[model samples]
Target: MTEVSNKTAVDPVERAIRRIQSVYGSWNRNTSVAQMRSDWDAAFAGCTVPESCRQASADGVDGEWIVPADAPRDKAILYFHGGGFRLGSIASHRDLIARIADASGCRVLAVNYRLAPEHRFPAALEDALAAYTWLREQDFKPKDIVLAGDSAGGNLVLTAMLSLRHRGEALPAAGVLMSPWTDLAATGESYLSRATADPIHQRSMILALAKGYMGDGGDPFDPLASPLYADLVGLPPLLIHAGDRETVRDDATMLAEKAKAAGVDVELKVWDGMIHVFQMFSEIPQAQTAMAAIASFLRRHLRLEAERVR
Candidate 1:
């Protein structure tokens, strides 16, 4: 069965994503990672910073804390920014994470995890784990925190949780995944089936990215690299958001299925006519709806009540 159907008109943001893909396709593969990073930083430079959020740095991990003027101090969201684990940074994703913090009425710490083709493999994962540990050291109870990420960042969140579980450490109250690329193996049917529909990612592009992040001969299905193949038991509740029009659509579906089969509490949401990481486009109404849903999920899972102002 085809993964994406022409059921609705394409949203303007999806069109924009198509343009981005075209531009990305034109980028010279021989370009240095530093140059690519600089280019991306410029592309997203116009993203407006939210006045409602306070930004900070932690242990060399760039962080942006978005908490309402009256929100609770004990609860937090440790967010990992996504860039195929090679590009993107706190500056690029700050606006989106700020919106999340505002929506959830909880503090959000957007961690600038190390990138690949330089840091590689466990570097991003290690930073994610370290950021979570830093949160714990700051007196945030594990059960009061939530783990959130998109794309490769999503992989980091899941792998970090798995590492914590294997070490018999405290786990977060829940997790939120937005268009997570959980399978580095590129085995998902959507990779081909949704090719025409998804403008943000293509199979060849994705595989090249995976290889860059993993280096030569890296096992693609190593649980950390591909959490789809990981043991899902003992993980906390999860909320996964995906765009029906995206190549990674099956990544979310398959992970949800596996988590459910493992008896983990998992909720999968597939938005029609949406593109990958559509939540990052603040202008899109569906993005707001998705944020509202994420906020509701966080409040429910974290037992957090919106603070009432005097």
Candidate 2:
């Protein structure tokens, strides 16, 4: 993995990491899932949804629409939030989605898929597929839709595409993943290499989250659950972002390699000194750069007009 050196002793990236650690580091196996969900939402409570955005439902799944004023009505981004499947909500990721909508000039449909430990494996995947199908039913063609997500949500993006392809359904134009946890088995080498560098997530934490999502009798290597083991042939173009310091860094790298081998167009970026899903922190300059790259990729794949993109 290529590393980008951060010359600044203490910068916005460091501060953001510290802040996240301060809030999330205290949690342990003893912490209740409800409390963790509350804490997670509270951490991003300051984020404000745009006035144009509104609460909406995709099929029966709860979600919100993030519509930039200039965004076209036809093209849309289907978003899934991260938090290891058991946590995160539309509220926690509203700001980041809003920024993406503004940058790409496409309305975003951010869904709050059912969480795990209660919903378990296949539940979130079902919700994601339902949302995508709902969008298709709305007359949004698959060519105009893009699937995007972070961490476990990124996992859903891949699985959703695979499922659709298996069912002989039309696939979306492209996909964008941020620090996707493709391997629920957590067997990536970066778990050992970047363990000390990643402040927010560790091997133990990842494994626990994975287990909770999988539950008893669930296979960690199941292609639907852990997409790294799945056949990636015929999947859409992908743009993957990862942090050099993240323990799951290899998840992004390995997936990109495998997808490319399977003839899928893949672009992988490993940001130096960044943490998992660093794009959530707008204060970090790298976050802005990553968002811009996302916009560019989406605009190209979605065939959005240059005048429409900001």
Candidate 3:
């Protein structure tokens, strides 16, 4: 643990996140997905699971509903998890989704989309679309829904919107992204520049995961696979959050710039000295602050009236 006693020392939040990165920094595609999921669960052992939720499976996607006590029934969040498209499930991300649920004061539907090497390319996208359609079937209006995710999940959130647009389907009110990997081609300059600085996520590992997800027939530049190359016009308002220390920093920055150039309402926030998906470290103060910012953005865009209990 970093010294929190010194006044001029690094912030405790920074220290905590760095510690987590150090412990799991070497983790990569070599690790079995099962073990990775187990490790993820252990990393968040301190977090309390949010209250009043149920598990359900429908339309070939598995998910859990996170309904915080006193949450509004009017709006909902469709959440996806991040593990480079190979690992991560609703179980690995339950607490994170629960935190978002608590902060947004709305129910969160976290999808366990199909993983790669087994299911490739459009499989996860199909699942996300299915989950959103299921939510609509539940009577949730398009504008009342908020799509949110981190890392690969963030990429899926963006691509899913593109998929919807291509199909002429309705869109959600807004989208929240955390350190999204918009380019599977790994073409961003930050990938090389921030490689040493980012405590987690190595370029080699990222490419390997991308290969697994892309399979033999998939193209990295496919708009649905890598939304960075996609047209951004007519998309919903977007709130993108990325840490300066992340290797994918340019992914978010470039995506935001491209989206803005294409006339989308985009708010990009780059936090100084933070790493990829810092929001996963709920014990970190910056993580808490970022979640609060997400809540404010969701509230404003969703037009939500309910205040968080915290």
Number of the predicted model whose lDDT against the real structure is largest? 2
Q: Name the 10 consecutive residues with the lowest summed lDDT in model 3.
A: 41-50
Comparing 2 and 3 on TM-score, the stronger one? 2
Better of 1 and 2 by TM-score: 2
Candidate 1 achieves a global lDDT of 0.85
Ranking by lDDT: 2, 3, 1
For model 1, residues 1-310, the per-residue Cα lDDT tens digits are 8597767887678666865665576578697788878877767654453435566666667677766666688999999888898899877787788777777778888878888888889888888888888888889999999999998888888999999999999999999999998999899999999999886788998999999999998989999889999999999999999999999899999999999999999989999988888888877889889989998898898898763342
lDDT of candidates 1 onward, in order: 0.85, 0.92, 0.86
TM-score of each: 0.91, 0.94, 0.91
What's the lDDT for residue 139 in model 1? 93
Displacement of residue 2 (Cα, Å) in model 1 is 44
